[model samples]
Target: MNIIKVRITVSLIFEKIFGKLLKGHERSIQAKKNIALSFLFKGLSITINIILVPITISYINSNRYGVWLILSSIISWMNLFDVGLGNGLRNKLSQTHAFKQYSRSKVYISSTYAVLLIVSIGIYLLFFLVNQFVNWYAILNVSQASIYNLNEVILLFVGFFCLQFILQVINVVLTAVHATSKVSLISVISQITALIAIYILTLFTKDSLILLVVALSGIPLLVQLIATFWYFSKQYKHLAPSFQLISFSQAKGLLSVGGYFFLLQIGSLVLFETDNIVITQLFGPNEVTSFNIAYKLFSVLVNVFTIVITPFWSAFTDAYTLNDFQWIEKIFKKMYLYWIFTIAVAVILVMISPLLYRLWLGNLAINIPILLSIAMVLYVAGFCWLMIHCYLLNGIGKIRLQLMLYIISTLINIPLAIYLGKIWGTAGVTLSNVFVFLYMDILLFIQCKKILNRNATGIWNM
Candidate 1:
């Protein structure tokens, strides 16, 4: 058939262009497949997210939407309470799966789940006790008149997030096994469900932030819960978490690595998540909305870059385990080329961003300054550049340098963000992030190069 001939012609062009680099390598082949499928799912997820933003803004005013963004950022801090177990489990499970050690992977899985479950319960209890005195309305810089149910909304979101925290471990588990496509599929389903729920709310119910929170937070949790049960019962049944496999001794190994990751998580939260809090405190919620709108627009490139490289975290683990340094070198070259492409795309997106905002948000797009879009382009470039080295280091388990850099970044970002926000408004906060990410990117790139060249020593090797 003509279709078959076209397929063959396209295959020939791909082979001719990339040549033997990906021809015989099973890791590269599998990674290509993951990238292909992830693009499909993530494309849908991105579209839904873009559509959700305008729809959400329509349902609630910009100030309330800004409050929601701030609250979500604050609640997301609790993900650190997992103490890096999720990522630790990711690296550990990837290594185990590489060696065909299913039993060992199961023990790691169960141990991580047991620890997260206990941590989630304790977090819920601790927050319940702490929530009474926190004065969240004041912290959010919103009036009680605007959101009387702020406390109840916080309580409801925390409850859903606590449960979702445990159930979402399935994502890490799937990624470890090179099943990131499934993880993307799960996210798409959750996003679709949330969109439908919100659409229904718009049809029947009055605009209530509480109901918005329920639809946004609760639906994802429900979907993840179903997926956790379904995946464990079928494809991953052999590695399901159970009381029998939960081992305190086994947990120490995960914590040993995860502990460092835990500290890094806190540092990351400070570096990335505090922008909204700072904007809300200093510039009010309206500017926060503008900052996020710009951020969301530019984040498309970051997400695409992530989809391409996500599979390589585990692939790097496999290669390093086998001492296949040449393969690592080849992949790094390919990644750099991709990074160059992202930079080009970021430039183009920045050029057309005003038109994009008009199309995406209509009148609501007026407040987002072009300066914010420019800074966001810089942020995305730094982020994509940093992720390349960071993932390889994490996969190869050389993160002491990354940990130190994040600590320094954490210390530097907040004051800089505040100082810059005062000077440049919301754009200043974003530029502050750009400065930190560029600093980290340079150092981590050095560490990655040294390790890959087999010349790293002392802290770099660590």
Candidate 2:
């Protein structure tokens, strides 16, 4: 009788604390679970990255490390060539799953894979044809003497890049299924494996960029490949992308939705990815390292915020499809509270960054100015805010306004980044990025509110 009373009391307390937040709706329950799991996996992934960086720097020197960073950024542009099909597949697949359209889902999956495979092949053959003609050393603003096997190294990077490009669609498929935590787990595994590979290389090999590229790029691709096979053969086998299911008609529907996403991806590449190249060109590869170290430090806040919001894209899609506005409104209110909490953490992170830099980079910590850290904090704050709004709009397939906004922002970023980079160095480039994020934040916040309240009209509706 005493034990029964105690159990009843504990259950009542749990209900009182989390009844609405955790137990009210199926969507809420799934989002909460994914967010919790993402925090666990992403925390481990970030820790591995932190440990991986210093070791990599010690192994290859900061300049070469910076070169690797810039090259990786440049190659990352290849992801855009999917023409939004990945995101198209994500949103479309999510909708199909919600409606239990299993056969259509398979067609969507197969068609996306077929299209991306064709794209990857074209990209690889194009690179093979042109690899010898371009002077990579001049393009990257690195000296030939500082690097060797340059063409071969780029070829290897591109090869791995194209293959990974096709395989990583599995991540999008997982996200669409509201299994975002699984995506985070894959990332954690890949990063951990890369860290281990780098450690082994340090012990047995000379500091060769080619070998570093192989270890860093190869491991992740291998993991994703295994995941693709395992998933297709098991849990998601029914929705597997088979050759016979390739449907250009389904592909057309996906492209219709994804065209805006493709453009947005391009604009994002310019806004975010070009900073390293700008830093390397205006300053040097060494400055790129200092800038990146600071970025990696402050990006902790952005990464954490992403974990909170990542699962919500598909959640929002489901709610919108079902006309569940009240749930969307309530969740946005909670998200606002979380956003405020993130801003507080960002300020705290900046306050202690000097000590962090010292511990994180040891003697390599001398160059990161307090100003750069401050700039990064502002950049992170704005980026996180923009993400909260953008995810909702994307989830609902109302992205025309976002597409237009990105075009305007992209046009402004490159020149502004160059101009500011000349005066403020790397911090200027970051501030330029902050400006773009701030612009999007104000407009997107207004748009999200209008749409949620059913007051959206004209461009705001889109």
Off by over 4 Å in 1: 1-22
lDDT of each: 0.91, 0.91
Clashes of 1: 0
lDDT of 1 by residue, 102-153 (tens): 9999999999888888999999999899888889988989999999888889
How does candidate 2 fare on TM-score? Answer: 0.96
Off by over 4 Å in 2: 1-22
In order of appearance, the predictions have TM-scores of 0.96, 0.96
Q: After superposition, how far is residue 44 of candidate 2 from its true place, in Å?
A: 0.3
Task: State, as a TM-score between 0 and 1, how close model 1 is to the true structure.
Answer: 0.96
Scanning candidate 1 in windows of ten residues, the lowest lDDT window is 16-25
RMSD of each: 2.2, 2.5
